[model samples]
Target: MRVRQAKRDQLVAEGVTPYPVTVPTTHSLAQVRADWGHLAAGAESGAEVAVAGRVIFVRNTGKLCFATLQAGDGTQLQVMLSAAVVGADDLGRWKSLVDLGDHVFVRGEVIASRRGELSVMADSWRMASKALRPLPVLHKELSEEQRVRRRYVDLIVRPEARQMVRDRAAVTRAIREVMHARGYLEVETPTLQTVHGGANARPFITHLNAFDLPVTLRIALELHLKRAVVGGIDRVYEIGRIFRNEGIDSSHSPEFTMLEAYEAYGDQESMAELTRELVLAAADALGSRQVAHEQETIDLDAPWSWLPFYDGLSVALGENVSTSTGSDRLRELGKEHGLDLDDDFGPQKMAMELFEALVEPGLIQPTFVCDYPAIAQPLARPHRSSPGLIEAWDLIIGGTERATAFSELIDPQIQRQRLVEQSAAAAAGDEEAMAIDEDFLQALEQGAPPMGGLGLGIDRVMMLLTGAGIRETILFPFVRPQV
Candidate 1:
């Protein structure tokens, strides 16, 4: 740190612009390597190339110096500087005024060293920016809470840290390609919502200053996209930020990207096909149809299991779990599993607790747990054949729920009743319960066609694909304020 500061002071004393407003370069280090591949060892490429990047490593000798530079895209290059060519005065400035992390532009000729490593032999250089503080040593690991606090510096030091971003971009592009090919028009929905009725999650509240009305950051993107369906935007999808005032963990973030898709004249079966296709597309984007995670290679090409929720729970518990299952039996099962179930815990909630405890962890392989209880899925239409079960499924992968889909409840009467029940739950002190949105109910009255909607947790999918933590997939994850 002191060395860098002294260099900055020396540059200031030299009457040099330590941080120039504009610094032009002809090549990124990556482009240089790719374009100059025809040049061989013991050959001088007759090209005068300009490259700008941060000085990552520097070694100084009497008349010769070598520095490693990294560009904004994380491309690294080796640079050789000689006083004989660049002149004594400029060499003096380079040695005394340049520091690691300083952005420097180098005009150079490409050459391979006797050792056969490609490098740039520089004739001239200039500082673009003089970095004041040193970066943290986080290439191996972040020591404490610095992972979220200093992600910029961390990305520079860690290669995979930046690659996660690139991989995620590729994943997104692949998804967009598939969605576009399938005729799903990408759409945007408002992040700030009036009633925040879409999913069951507590919302971040804020007051709209102009209107002086309380609004909430949207917890999901379902309600408005369905309105678009009502208006004849038949096939639609949104890759957007979903905010939830929830606990932070490896699998949860307060704000994260979500992919919500809806297609008219579709149901859980149609969504299942789209969901599988999307996941397969993501795998292909990452250069494989399967990815290795948690010491297991998940086979994307393998047939996906479609298990009814009750059957999965029953298989895990060795006890019958169905709509006919008694509350006393559920209570006994919950107690047997050491779950916190009380009189207030209804049959559906008890089933959820038991499945989450017993079945979810074992679903390390990809599986679709379907037929959620109607009472538990207010947004799902009741199954055609099953009177009390909703046609819904949660795609579970690597032992975590990755996506949720349902045959959407479109009847205005039924939708209104569900929202009213949700509002009642909210009034009874469930912060994560939905509030009635009269406008959406009105849209329902306008005759929304039967549609299937799926919400995929983007961060979680990236985590599975890239083998990164949920926060690692996020460019800047939230952290508590440091004291």
Candidate 2:
């Protein structure tokens, strides 16, 4: 509403359009911040700067007024104006036309305020964009629920929220840099596929008008990244999005970012080592290897502990928790744990429930739970020494499953059989069962190299780095649709 009025007033009085189609920028917030002290120390001669940002706060002292502006790159600058330079009429005009949340370009010189605050003394300013609605004033009183409900407002009021997101961006950049340095080529893959074959999760379905068929959003990037390995990319990675139609919780999002990487001739051990290194690198980028989250400190330095899956489960449960036990015994154990295990929740599923419900939550330290049950790892190669186990590992940190990796199953026949089993499960009413992908099996037949594959939750990593709760880390976590 204010934007329309501003445009009309600009045209009527100044003969200028409020919204100019184009504007060129010479410098960023980072550059100016870097040279801030030098600029402040310099003589107040003819230093002119063109800066654009949203007006965050305002203060008026009769003749002189100050407003805080925030640029896109997470930098804040205080803008000052004096009636001696701006003229009484122009100052009144600014006060009438400008509002909080308005984007404006200012021509200014750097100076220090009476309180020794660095400020940009403005000679002139013009509107870049005008906001229609008033931003919610969250600083005064806001609940956690309200903050989540109005995240954009929360971002405006909470400087910590902005800082945490910036930290997340820094972590992502560090991940890319480390991967590039390690010779991994980043690639993109299809998000909507005919078959969601990678992970055990229900997928969101959508229709493709162009293809004239229904397609499911990908649940994981594992299958396609491995296909890139088959296409002869020695080391490949994808930082992408995945959709899972499931319950909302402290740890899960319906649509989330995933980081999946595959390296040829690498095993679960190699992937576990890389996971530790990458996580540590991210922590270092955040300025410390020590991060405290949820009442505990996590040291991401080096040499994370590795425990065999059965052993870790046993340690957590105070008893031997092995899937190698007979099917009947596994069912009995599941029943003891109050898990309704029938022929439908097969021996493998029963064992998995016992481990997940009774064991996973106890792995608070950074530990790799290695060697999963064969039935638990559909895409992992079988362990050579343990016939019933697969060479897969899950990295557990702060009692959360942060990442999972494995030596990939490259045998086409074995891959096909496992997929068939999943298909049967789906037919038998397991909605989260992986779909059989014939094309993926064909690609496997064409020969994918023995490779280590990893799928890491980037948001979970951010949660660890920022010491933020789950919803706090995400910009707009999914909520129930309003009636």
Candidate 3:
């Protein structure tokens, strides 16, 4: 209420218009400051420059004062002001009106101060937008939780946080550019689905008042993109948000972006090669083949290792988890890992959990684990030689699962049976289990061609590239309500 009242008072005192016209911006603070040192010696004068930024800090030294402002490109610049330079006519007016946290535009000449600091000498200035309440001040005394909660304030003061955001943006751009270069068409899939049947993750449920139906937020883009591939839309991808009803930790979020792609006539091997290429391209854009996160440096340029899922299981379990082992052996292995191998626990579920508990996190470097059990990958095609294994590969990086890809199963009979099995799992109180999508199965029956598909976590990739922890990479990460 106080903030609202202050905003109203500001408008009244300044005689600000109800609707303000647009102002054109010339250059960013970064472009100006990058050459500030060289230009300060023989600074340009009498040049009209329009700069706009949110005022972060303000300090007055009698008749002279200084304020630091943050521009759009995350660049901070100090602006110096004196009563004499502002003019006696407007000095009193400026002194009465100027406040911290306000967005202002200044038309000025680039110049150097007495202390050899670069600054913009104002010829004319106007408030673009007024910030009613003072923001949290810049100081070294703030706590970590306070800083994380008030990230906008932290971005103004912390260079590392600002750089992390910038780097994340760059990596996102690099991904799109690489996909576009490879002739992949960017597409949008539905966020709300009647039957959410992609991937193994519980979804956030919502209701549609208009349709009088309950819908679930998409947990993955795989099912729909594969449908498109069946419709003859080759080489397509979607960088979209997926919602999962899951526990939050350093690596998990309820809502996050997934970059999923599908290519016609390709297989898991092709997808793995593409994943490596795309990651390497992003690493090059980051200007380093390696990225630091915590105490470890992930070598992105290093040759990615490819190992069969069975081989990885053998290494971890001390026993071979072959398809020929039948359900009894798989159940025993699950029991050894403290996993409940129930009646619904088929070869796929048992093998998947075994991988998660054993082999997944052990992959500290970039490695692709392939030949997942067909039971584990319902939508993936089975390998010709290994009847029990699907042509699937999951790219694990820095002890985390980065991406999952596979050769899509287009045989309508096989797809139906897999969906039926998945439906049974969902019926058995497994919320993360996939639901049978008759529409998808119908599309497959329409003679969908064999294709390769990939789903990569964009958030995790950004986390790796920016060398920031999971919470740091994401802006506005969900937090529980404080009472």
Candidate 4:
């Protein structure tokens, strides 16, 4: 570290800046390789090319020096600086200024060495940015905590870490492509709202200095998108951030990315195909249809199916579970499976909890768990065939819920009644209860079309394809303050 600092000081002594704002280059290393890399061994294209990258490796062979320059996308090429070619005077000063981590521009002709390795024989070089500290020599099997703390360093040292970023971008692009092709209008929604009622989760509260009114970070994107639907933007969607003041787990983050879309004149059942298309699109973007998770391989290429909620629970537990199932009965069955429930949980909440515990874990394949109890889905339209049930689907893969789809209830009276029930639950000590947003109800009174909507967890989708935990997929997950 001290030696690198001395080199930086030496640049100032020679009236040169160690860091320049910009270093122009004619081509990237990857571009050069693609356009003219067909040259055979012991061949020279005789093409003068200019390139810039960070120096990753350096070697001195007396008369000639070889350094490996790496671009941001992990592209690397050998750079040969010879005393005879670049002149001893400039070569000496170049060596003094450049280090392994320093960014530089090299002008050279492409050639092949005796070992048949493609390389750039440089005639000159210039520094773009200088690094003071050295990069670590990384190894496989890094712990989660250590990697999170040193993410920037880990990104350079671990190839998979960098690939995660590229994969994330590709997946996101695929999502937008699928949405746009499906005729959905992409839109942005407010992150800050006076009331957050989209999903049933505790929200992080904050204060607005300008208005002196308390505000909350949005926990879901559904409410506002519905408002747009009321305004006649029939098919609107947004890929945005959602904040939840909840527990952190392998599949849960306090703040995460969501892909939410709404379509007028559609029902919960209508979102099934859209959900499948989006997931398949993401898999296609990654160029694979299979992923490994905890010693099991999930094949996404297989056809997906819908599993009726109560019937599936009945099969999983060897007991019939339905809307009529009492909270005491559900709790009793949950105890049989070694699962505990709090006394405050209602029947609908108890049944869903049991389903998550005894049913979802066994559903490792791509399946939609459909038809929730009406109490479980207040904002969902009631099933035409079964008033006790609502038209909703929870898409589960590899034992984790990946997305949610539902036929939004647009009738103002029913919507108001359900939200009133939710508010009652909130008053009764359920912190994750929905609030009765009168403005949202007023919008509903103005008539919202029968709509189908889906909210996909971007991080969970990445986990399914990358075979990594949610935290591993997120670039910078929340961590405790350093002591």
Candidate 5:
């Protein structure tokens, strides 16, 4: 650090700007390579162009110097500074002042070196930006802790890190394209709300000073987006951040991106088709519908399988199970299957725990587990045929719940009753229960069309596409403070 600072001081003393306000550039490193890379060895294009990038590699011989410049997208171009072209004095200054991490601007004729490496033969160069600290050792792997703490450095040093950002954007754009193509209106919803009655997740609470009322960072976009449907926007969707006061793990983050779309006059089956299309579209954006994850290849183009929640549980348990199964019997079955069932767990909760442990892991292919217990999803309509089940499905891929859809419950009276039950649970010390939101209820009362809503975890989708963990999908995921 001191050595770099001394070099910066030396440049200032030499009447050179170490941190110039601006520099002219005619092409990105990518464009330069795309246009001039085909030149034969020892051939010069005579196309003088300006380019700027961070210096990643440098070597100086007495009369000639070579420095590799890397652009933000990880494109590299070699800059050859010959004493004849740049003059001996400037060439010498470049060797002395340029560092691996410093940004430099160069004006040069595009050419291929004697060894056939495409390069820029410099006529002039200047410092664009100086770095006070050295970069990490090149080609050395960074520890997970260091990578997460210094993501800027990670993005610079790791090609995969830069690609992850591009892939995420591609996935998001693909989702929006699918939504817009289906005539869904993309919209934004309030991040802070008086009541967070959407998903079954605890919210991060905060105080609103002006209104002098407690508020929470929204845990889901389901409620407000549904309100839009009630307001006559037949189809609406939101790709936004959701905050949950929850535990962190390989697949869970306290804050993450979610895509919630509600289509009026659509049933759970309609949303399932949309969910399939979205997944395939995202996979297509990443250049393949087949993804490699955890030693398995997931074929998004293959026909997806469907299983009722109880039937899946029954298969996993090697016995028939349904809503009629008693809590005590379910607990016995759970214990036999190696689950430590909580005493307070009801029949539905116990069945779910057993299913998650035994069934979810083997659902490597795209499978829609349908007809969950009615209490499991308060916002879903009752199953047309099954008395105790809801018209909902959880899309499980790569052994994780990637998305969920519901035949939305629009009957105001039934919706209120469900929220009332959820409110009681919240009051009874269930932190992950939804609270009653009067405004949402009023919107339902104003008459909403029969709708099907789906919420997809953007991060989890990235994880599947990139074979990365939840934190790696996020640019700057939350990390614990250093002690």
Candidate 6:
């Protein structure tokens, strides 16, 4: 670091700008390769082009110097600096001042070396940005802790890191395309909410100084998007951040992106179809529907299976299970399955815990586990045929719940009753219970159409598409503070 600083001081002493205002570039390194990559050995294209990138590699052999420039998209271009072309004085300055991590600009003719390696033969070069600290060794792998803490460095050193960013963008773009194509209007909602009731998750709360009221970061995008449906935007969707004051793990993050959409007059089946299309679209964007995750190949192209929630739980437990089952019996089943069930947990909660433990892990393919118990999803309408089940489905992909949809409970009276129950749970110390939002209830009272709402975890989708962990999918995921 001291050596690089001394070089910067030397450049200042020489009346040279270590950090220039602007270094014009005519082509990206990728563009340069595409345009002149066909040149024969010892061939020069006679076309002068300006390009700039971080210097990742350098080798000096007195009169001849070679440096590799890498662009943001991980494209590498070799620049050949000859004393004959750049002049001896300039060549010496390049050798002395240019470091591996520094950003530099080069104006050069397209050429191929005697060995037919495509390169830019530099006529002139300048320091675009000087780096005081050296980069990590090119071939050394960064530890997981270091990779998340210093993502910028990870992006620079690991091609896979850069590719993950591109893949996430591609996945988001594909989601928007599918939504727009289906006539869904994209919208944004308040991030700081007076009441957070969208999903059953604890929220991060803060005090709003202007209103002198307590506010919470939104835990889900469902409520307002549904309100949009009530306001006559028949199709609405939002791909935005959701904060959950929850535990962190390989599959869970406190902060992550979510895609929530609502379609008026649609039911759980319609939303399920949309979910399938969206997942396939994202998979297509990543160039394949077949994904390898955790020693399993998930074929998104194949027909996704449907498992009725209670039936799946029953199969897993080797006994019949339903909403009518006693809470004590469910607890016994949970204990048998190695689940540490809470004493306050109701039958529905116990059933859900058992399903998550025994059934969810085996759902390796794209599967829609439908018709959950009413208490499991307070916002879903009652199932038409099943007495105590709700019309809802959780899309599980690669053994993870990637998306969920509900035949929305638009009946204001029923919605209120459900929220009342949830509110009671919240008061009784359930941190993950939904609060009664009077405004949302009023909106429903004003008459909302029977809509199907879907919420997909964008980070989990990226995880499935890229076969990366949740933290890798989120560019700057939350990390523990270093003491």
TM-scores of all candidate predictions against the true structure: 0.96, 0.89, 0.89, 0.96, 0.98, 0.98
Clashes of each: 0, 0, 2, 1, 0, 0
Ranking by lDDT: 5, 6, 4, 1, 2, 3
RMSD of 6: 1.3
Which structure is stronger by lDDT: 1 or 2? Answer: 1
Q: List the residue pairs that clash in candidate 4.
A: 268-407
Residues 80-130 of candidate 2 have per-residue lDDT tens digits of 888888788867767767777777777777676666666778888877776
Model 6: lDDT to the true structure = 0.92
Work out candidate 2's RMSD over C-alphas.
3.1
Candidate 1's clash total is 0
Q: Can you tell me which runs of candidate 1 are displaced by over 4 Å?
A: 137-140
Residue 152 displacement in candidate 6 (angstroms) = 0.7
- What is each predicted model's overall lDDT from 0 to 1? 0.88, 0.80, 0.79, 0.88, 0.93, 0.92
Candidate 1: tens digits of C-alpha lDDT, residues 140-171: 57753575678887778877778888899998
Between 3 and 4, whose TM-score is larger? 4
| Worst 10-residue lDDT window, candidate 1 | 136-145
Tens digit per residue, CA lDDT, model 4, 1-483 = 999999989887888788887877999999987876777878888999999998888886677899998888998888899999999977887767787788888999998877777888999998878899887753445677878888887787778899998999999999999999989999999999998788899999999999999999999999999999999999999999999999998888999999999999987767888988899999999998887778478888888889999999998778988888888888888899898998888888888888888899988899999989887667888998986899999999999899998988999999999999899889998888898999999999998888998999999999999888888889998877799
Off by over 4 Å in 5: none
Tens-digit lDDT track of model 6 for 1-483: 999999999989989889999999999999999999999999989999999999999999989999899999899989999999999999999988899999999998999999898899999999999999889987779999999999999999999999899899999999999999999999999999998888899999999999899999999999999899999999999999999999999999998999999999999999999999999999999999999977588999999899999999999998998878988898888888788888887888888888998999899999999989887789999998989999999999878999999999999999999999999999999899999999999999999998999999899999888878898998999999999
